[model samples]
Target: MSLLNGLPAHVLLVHVVVVLVPLTALVLVICALWPQGARRLGPALPVLALVTLASVPLTTGAGEWLERHVADDPLVRRHAELGDGMLPWALGLFVLAAGVWLISRRTPAAQAGARSGAVLRVAAAVLSVVVAAGAVVEVYRIGDSGAKAAWHDAYSKTATRPGDGD
Candidate 1:
């Protein structure tokens, strides 16, 4: 058998990292912050955040080309829209982290400033929460499309079957 498959590396990379890793990290973030246990589970927060953040641009850019070439279907369109929305949220979080990193360096020891306080914390939490929620929604959507897309062959089979075409 030939060693190389026809699948593109970009497509493979997108499925593995962008879709799975970020969602896994998002879940890990919540798990790491679980109320009852020690919070040692999330050592990779910064790394996870950075990876997820960096992927925003790459995914969206690849998507732009994919959208142009792929067959235009309602499901694909919806998927594109959902994927597109992730860019801004990811970029915003990355920007917020940068701002916090800069200002934290200048702030005093006793208080890390109000940016780490309830207001800003809550806002960041809300933004990430929304992004996570949207991701979940999109996952369900993608899953549904997968199910329907699988049926396309069966669908055509049934349509053409047993004198159906007359």
Candidate 2:
């Protein structure tokens, strides 16, 4: 888990987390806000959420391993802290997605035109919006910090073309 194809595993696993988290969050919002979307896409949401949630641990574990090997720096420490915080957000998204799917799956007989069913759906929708927003923002923050940690001082202020020796 520490390395992949001779590169740090975090470099690869992070892509999975960065892509899936936002994609799954968008799907959750769509399924929550639109009934047609829910009916059409709800069945797959829980699985997507589960996959997204699962990636967080792998990415973070690999990140933690990478962190241990790299020199100590404040930027890296900040990025690692933000990366660790992603677990709870991912877990919340999964729980909300699963709940929404379950709610969508209730048969008419089971729902029985219950007021509580409608109430729960509304609640789930609200929570989905909040959680999705938070997750996206957190992902952005983590990515920005990670970029700073990895590339902040690795580049020159001005670019030079090939054979531009001075």
lDDT of each: 0.50, 0.92
For candidate 1, the lDDT comes to 0.50
- For model 2, where is the 10-residue window of minimal lDDT? 157-166
lDDT of 2 by residue, 64-111 (tens): 999999999999999999999999999999999998888878876656
Estimate, for each residue in 2-82, the C-alpha lDDT of model 1 and write its tens digit: 111664333544554346544643643353233112123333444455676776567556655666765677766766666
Which number leads on TM-score?
Answer: 2
Error of 1 at 122 (Å): 4.4
* Model 1: CA > 4 A from native: 1-5, 17-43, 92-119, 142-166
Give me the displacement of residue 30 in model 2, in angstroms.
0.7
Question: Which segments of candidate 2 are over 4 A away from where they belong?
Answer: 108-112, 162-166
RMSD of 2: 2.5
